[model samples]
Target: MEVVVGVDLGGTKISAALVDESGNIVADVRCHTQVEKGREFVIEQLTKTVGELFERAEGLGKRVLAIGIGSPGIIDPDSGVVVKAAVNLPQWEGISLKRIFEERFNVVAFADNDVNVMALGESLFGVAKGLKNVIFIAIGTGIGGGIVVDGKLYHGSTFTAGEIGHMTILPEGPKCACGNYGCLEALASGPSIARRAKEYIAKGVATSLSELVDDEITCEHVAKAASKGDALCRRLLEEAGRYIGVAVASLMNVLNPDCVVIGGGVAQAGEILLTPIRHEVALRAISPAPVLQSLLRENAGEIGAAALAFSKLAEKD
Candidate 1:
């Protein structure tokens, strides 16, 4: 069996999987990313994960082909370098992820922004399949996006075109981690949702969510509470969905994409979130398209990474 390695590298964790040509996972491994320990430690963790995958491949009579990495931040997709990123990964500036991995593993490698590859995954195997124009939104701890136009990923002039989270929806709302006030991220992301719940609790509002997670309340807790009919959590999620809808509506009006996809941890809240997002998009959009959830979900990152490698390689051929 021949397989490509796909890595989903994030702030909190790293997941690597060996995938065959048909998108089947031959083997996989994951580990917590102690990013605070410095770049070298992070590299060590990646090496261990990949090395384990290679070992498993050998044991399973598989021939490893190449590597694909989906990492957070502005990656030079053509060159496979991490140009810049947020504080999540510390001093991760100007690192050539492709060069480093190819040198270490002695194989071809490609790297890209996490959400970009995820969008690619959707285009290839998920909701946006066969669409010429598409938009993908990730609503996790933070928010991010990817855009495809004319069946090609749009990198924009600066390669940062899809930072949808920074779009200003609330002109005077809460400050985001990016130091921008009223960013969609600060208003609609998972952390933002949890923050809203926390704010209500601070105001002495009565909600069972407080009893669920105490001061350590998270977005998952809010979603869980909402599922159980907790009115406060439902209200918070609906508000976040509306905020997301505003942004999505804005994008749809400008891009006129055939499809838009919502993925990431918060998206798992399902219809509670999607319903309001749909309502807002329908209300505000000039030419509306259906908003749908990701079919791949957690697997999108790794699968998309593999798909990224395959696509780039095919282009080379």
Candidate 2:
């Protein structure tokens, strides 16, 4: 059974796993990103984590074939470099990630935007399996998307093709971190939902959410409140759903993918979120197409990174 190392690099932690061809995780390890220590420290930590995982798998009699890393930023797939990222780690810009891993492990190393890896995983072994031309959108603290065309991930000319979060939804709405106005992320992301709820609470609205937590409310709290029939929280989620639906409708008009799979933390809202999104999609979708729910949800990132490693190993054959 051939195995590969799959690494998911997030703002908070780095998760590495040995994955088999069947998408089974044989062993896994994790460590803090330690972003405050600078780029060199982060790289050293990643290298150590990969090395440890490789050694562990080898000790278990597993032959490691390749390594795949999913990073949160603009990644140049062909060059195996991270162009830019602003979330957790600093100074990751222009880092030759692939070369570092390949030189150290003496094996092929594949790296891509975190979301793209997630999409690849879904296409290969999860919900989008056996399907061509699919869209994977993850709505978490922020929003990100990946496009897979004809069973292959599409990296547009700069290898920054799928930036669904930056899509302008409201021409004159809130300002976004990317210096854009009214982006889908600005309106419907997890932070956006929490912000809206906070505003209502500040305005003296009587909501059950107020009694749940004292300071710094979160999307999870809002979802729980809404589930208990909190009108304000429910409204906030509906509003977010509507915004997400509008964005999906526009994307459908442009790409018309076979399916739009949504994942991430906020997706846990489940029917409360999906119902409104579906309603809006039906109302505004240009082609009146069907919207499919995500199969892998929160696990897409990890599994997708693993799939990418498997893909790289297969390519070498």
Candidate 3:
């Protein structure tokens, strides 16, 4: 069976896996990204991780055909270079990731944004399976999104098509890391949600979240508080959900996707967050798509990268 190496390069961690054509993970490994280190060191660590996966694949007698990487920032899929991504990792811009992997492994390599690859994985093998159109939104420290149309991942002219997080959801709300005011990420991301709860706690609103965390509250704390019927936490999450829903509603009207898949850490709030999203979409969108959760968690990027590698390999064949 043909196998490939899939790597998910995030700001915090680097996850690599050997996956078969059927999307089954044969071997997987992860380590801190050490993004504080220079680009050369991070790339070296990625190469070493891929080497380990290759060794494992060879031990299983599987022929490794290609390598695929899912990374953050504005990526040039054609060249497999990061055009610009100085937000999370310093000096990550203009990195020729494709050339590095191809020269080291002596195999075909492909790369794209992390969220885009996650959308590909879900559309092909996860919640949006067999669907030709999908919108994937990941809400964690920040929000990111990906779009798949007609069974292919859609990268806009500048390869920044799936920046759903940067969409201006509130014209005059909180400032986003992207230097935009009132972006969806600023209002509804995990940190944003936590900030809301923290603000409330500071105002002495009297909630269980303050008891859970000593210094600052997190989305997980808010989720747990909501689960325990904390009115403040529940309301905060619901408000965030409404903001997400409004953004998704706009996407639905324009893209007309069959499914919108939600994932990432904040989405663990589940029904508390999903219910409001569904409600707002139903109310605002002309024709709303089904909103679902991601099937794969940490493995989403790995599977999607493997699928991307398989796609690239097929194109060559």
> For each predicted model, how many residue pairs clash, with residues at least 3 apart or on different chains?
0, 0, 0
Model 1 misplacement above 4 A: 212-214
RMSD of each: 1.7, 1.7, 1.3
**Model 3 stretches astray by more than 4 angstroms:** none
Model 1, residue 292: C-alpha shift (Å) = 1.0
Candidate 2 at 65: error in angstroms?
A: 1.1
Candidate 1 global TM-score? 0.94
lDDT for model 1 comes to 0.90
lDDT of 1 by residue, 1-317 (tens): 78989999989999999988877788899999998899999999998899899899999999888999999989998888888875788578889889888999998999999999888888877887878788999999899999988766789877898999999998899999999899999999988899899889989898997776556899999999899999999999999999999999999999999989999999999999999999999999999998989988989999889978877777789
lDDT of model 1 at position 15: 93
Best of the two (2, 3) by TM-score: 3
- Cα lDDT tens digits, model 2, 27-59, are 888898888888888889899999998889878
- Candidate 2: residue pairs that collide: none
Q: Write model 3 residue lDDT over 206-308, tens digit each, in one string.
A: 8887676645678888899899999999999999999999999999999999999999888888999999999999999999989998887779989989878
Per-prediction TM-score: 0.94, 0.94, 0.97
